[model samples]
Target: MARTGWLRWGSLGVAVLVLVVFLVAQRQSVDVSYGQSPSSSGTVEEGSAGELSDATVPSVEEMSALVKASPVVRLPGSTAYWDEARVNAVIGDAHILVAPPGLDEAERGRVRDVEEAGIRVIGTEVTGGAYQATADTLPDWRAQFATGDVTNLLVTLAAGIAKRPTPPDVDGFRWREPTAAEVEPVAADLRASGLHVAAGATLAKVPDSAKTAFPDGALYVALPRQPYGEPVPNFGPALVKLFPDKPIVVLYGEWIEYHGPREADFASVAAASFYGQAADRISRYAYPQGNVLHAYLNRVTDVRYAGLFDRPLPYVPLDPLRVALPALPWLFAACAAVFLALSATSLRRKAFTTTGTPARLAGLTALAIEVSGLSHDPSVVRGIAKLTAASEALAENLPDQHVRGLLDGASRDLDEVARALGRNDYLSDVYLRGRVA
Candidate 1:
């Protein structure tokens, strides 16, 4: 039964492994085809085949040269452009492209002029007006906020960000619990300081409708107070749930009255760790943004520890790998639960009444030999001794009182047979007269 159960589990594992391998192979085998186009520059235009010419497709080295020569590379516009670029296996520096938003004749002429002037034009959905307003332009955060202290604080934050050296790899800035007054200026300051604030998504505490009003590249700005009357402890996890894809950097101020000044407090660190572990990273700051903007940027870039002694460590960033890592614990737990359930099912099917059958048969055979006057033989005596030990072991496993008593009696009878053989005249009738019946 034990061997069969092991084989069953092993087969299940093998089947699952084969299925996963087969699925991966099927995905890899499918070919992805690119549409043909007629454009000389090799940028795939919006929609259908016959848009971009294959012969003019830019090589990786060529694209790199074009980007290096141009002051600003416009972001590529259509899905067709990406498909064509991917077909060439071009892996170069990311380019920024600008395009006329409309398909009007005048707009096409403008694009042609830009292309003809040695500024290689890339296809894009963004119009000239939108690009001028948002992309690379410094935002006015103070205007978005109310005319009060919150606006003043945000303006100061923006100024501080502008003065400080930009943090590495920061696509944009995200504010936790931002009020309406704080979002725009912070984004603007970061943008003016050479940080790419336009790439980030805006998640603010303002009305759901107003969240879209912030300039491109701004993260969330938190409300000053907690929302929905939730406890302070719940803020971090809830915030993380809202933006599960992006790497979270929770910048908490210690001087902020609600949090107090306990940098290494267990409850505080634990609560923060829960948030960090849920998303990407978290940090606790002892000072305000005014004096420590540089330090703040440093901490934001390298969020290894939460406090001075590294009281709480930042969690793994919510990358593809991090997203998969969490499922491991759950997978192990599910396997354990299945194992337990299987064991329980096996136990339920096992019949206790059949447990001592072998011992009973061996004991009866020994008894018959002894009664036939073979007790005097050395082989019969040894057989009786082995059968006695077997009966004793089987007695322990039989749960029924009568079965246990029967096994015990058989063991005794086997022992008596061996003992009686020692005395030449003594014939043991105990096996025939006792619990064997």
Candidate 2:
């Protein structure tokens, strides 16, 4: 071969190799920064948070009135066993705590007992705490639904948070920061989806821009404010100064959670989560030790009666765009180019006809259909495929209105359904978080 020809072929091979590598690695994946396990459930066997006496379960009108009167709605039930004091504590607090998986049929029956008595059975769910949530963890409300009970509609979707700048002061804990700028985008998606988001960080430390960009959410403050004595989290609206109208919840109080000396020790920590803090709501992470449940409830009840958070806790809900306008840059560019090309060429001369085999189009369409529903919402995938088919078919000389409608309407319908079902942006959570890093 001539030297020039050899050089050109070699260069072409390198380019091809690079393109192949990029293509092979393009599927997005999210990298999770696992939180600390500084630790580390049995129920009352009956499943009640034990806070309520058998007769104390509220009635429907009272449940309604109770929630209306209080800022916090306690989920009553038990996941682990509690001591006498702890059990008493739960009843006095009037808020209930329970674990879903640990509930025996009888325990579940008691929760139903409460519900039958007119008290709202389901309440807030948490990810990992003293009882950390795994990928498989689900709230009891989900169980209620499975059994064909459709009373409460709210379920808490908690994500593991990264306390910025490594080796969080919480001791024996660590979370990896994203290499990708995943926080802003993920946070944006959460806000758009209308789900409540709480990330770990000190309000004073988080960047101003980060605070502004956060779609509506709260600060899961856990650092700097070492839990040596007791946490008297700054009360009132002072949190708004740092978070700018955002609520501040103590993920860790007095000291970080998940680090108690004994599993039961979390009872005090759980108690502290409510005591001497500014937050209207607190997560009692005392793990496995259901004994702590009552103490946790007592604090919640105490704070409520104490008239704290008399004013509404700072709340700023996130506002996402009503309709997505194609987030991919390549798609935008392709559309823009097509528009300009059609505008100039059609006006000045005959429209250019696209050339391709109908068989090739048919094959691609069949292939897309086979895989369209494999991942995300099948409706969305089918709709997107339809639109893509409609667009490509036009280019290849076959325009189908059916495909167009499928794309426009079916895709949108799927999106709405996914939202209604509380389906999260799984791809974004994983893909964006990892790829961006």
Candidate 3:
């Protein structure tokens, strides 16, 4: 009836409504599934093919030698397609470009023919550059270094580079950047020994295309720098597509300068090494072209190398602890919901015990009286009176005999209390009679 009572009831109604809305909003917002896309074979076509040729394919022994000797190995057939002029231009005065075994005619032809068979191939130059350079260059030998007049050697060696026919038993020399002090001495020794040499004048003259792939100048462990130009990436992708079901383990190699002289000593001396730079970038979820496979490869593949591995990329099925830990938060939320439901049920039971049940009924009757004044219509007041009578009838039938007796006494006094309030009398004749009794 008073202003404070109306304010209290109105505030309680608003608070209950707001709490319900907030809980519904929170339940709708929770998401359990990963937002990361499921692995799909993006634009890569799986196909069947027979073993075409093994003649030019490097033997396991040859690959082992190449992997150990070379600072960087270009995949498919680890060979640089650079002509002598391109080699001299990139390496400058002090360099020995070890020409390795390249793709054979059968393999190079396969690149062109695979598409005719309905397989999609990307990143291969259709023309003569990479394919022609391989057939033209000498394999498994000390390639001619810079010689005589700097301007004339490029023209002279271009024709002679592919003319050699010998395959040496020894492994090819591994190419490395020579310091300024070591340049002239190495060139002089190669020239004296009658080996054609690339002079020191052209160090880094030709910009490497591989460098362009990574504009930020952050070097990747898997990306190899070649003197000629970019290697044809078509071969690796084509072969991978043939055996789409097979799991291929790709291993990345670090720059020779990053590791110690001996493998056993295995310490990284440079901060810009593979472990330092590339891994750091990748750990921050930075993938080139937004491809995780490309991030792992450190170079973009010609095809989407997805669905190749049976398990997901960065697979962690082997670690149960890792899997379970991430799920613990969601599990805890489920448990909390169950706990709150049980607690509310238990509190309701406790509140309606013998003494509490009668008190709650009386409070409900008082609440009905307060709500009756909110509307002027007599029907609304009649409805409130009927609801209070229904609540009293339900409480009287509760199994507890003690609770029923208490409810009956509260019901008997309710009419006299209502009459005293209606008469605006704090001490009326009915209340005096009850006190005397």
TM-score list, all predictions? 0.17, 0.20, 0.21
Task: Give all candidates' CA lDDT scores.
Answer: 0.32, 0.32, 0.30
* Clashes, model 3: 11
Q: On a 0 to 100 scale, what is the lDDT of residue 324 in model 1?
A: 50
Which candidate, 1 or 3, would have the higher lDDT against the true structure? Answer: 1
Q: Which stretches of candidate 3 lie over 4 Å from their true place?
A: 31-217, 221-437
C-alpha displacement of 280 in model 3, angstroms?
A: 26
Best by TM-score: 3
- Give me the runs in candidate 2 sitting further than 4 Å from their true place: 28-104, 107-116, 120-437
Model 2 Cα displacement at 249 (Å)? 17
lDDT score of residue 113 within candidate 1: 44
Candidate 3 C-alpha error for residue 12, in Å = 3.3
Question: After superposition, which runs of candidate 1 have C-alpha atoms over 4 Å from their true positions?
Answer: 1-71, 74-258, 265-437
Ordered from best to worst TM-score, the candidate numbers read 3, 2, 1
Tens-place lDDT per residue, model 1, 1-437, is 78767854654354344334434544643333221211122222332222222222233454455556764454333111122222122212323333312233333444444431222222222223112111111111111111111222222222233344322221122234544353445445433541211122221222222122111222332222222112232233343344343222222221111121232353244333333331111011111222222222222223222233323444535655335544543443343334334433443344334434553444354343433243333333344334334444443664455544554554455456556566422223444345446
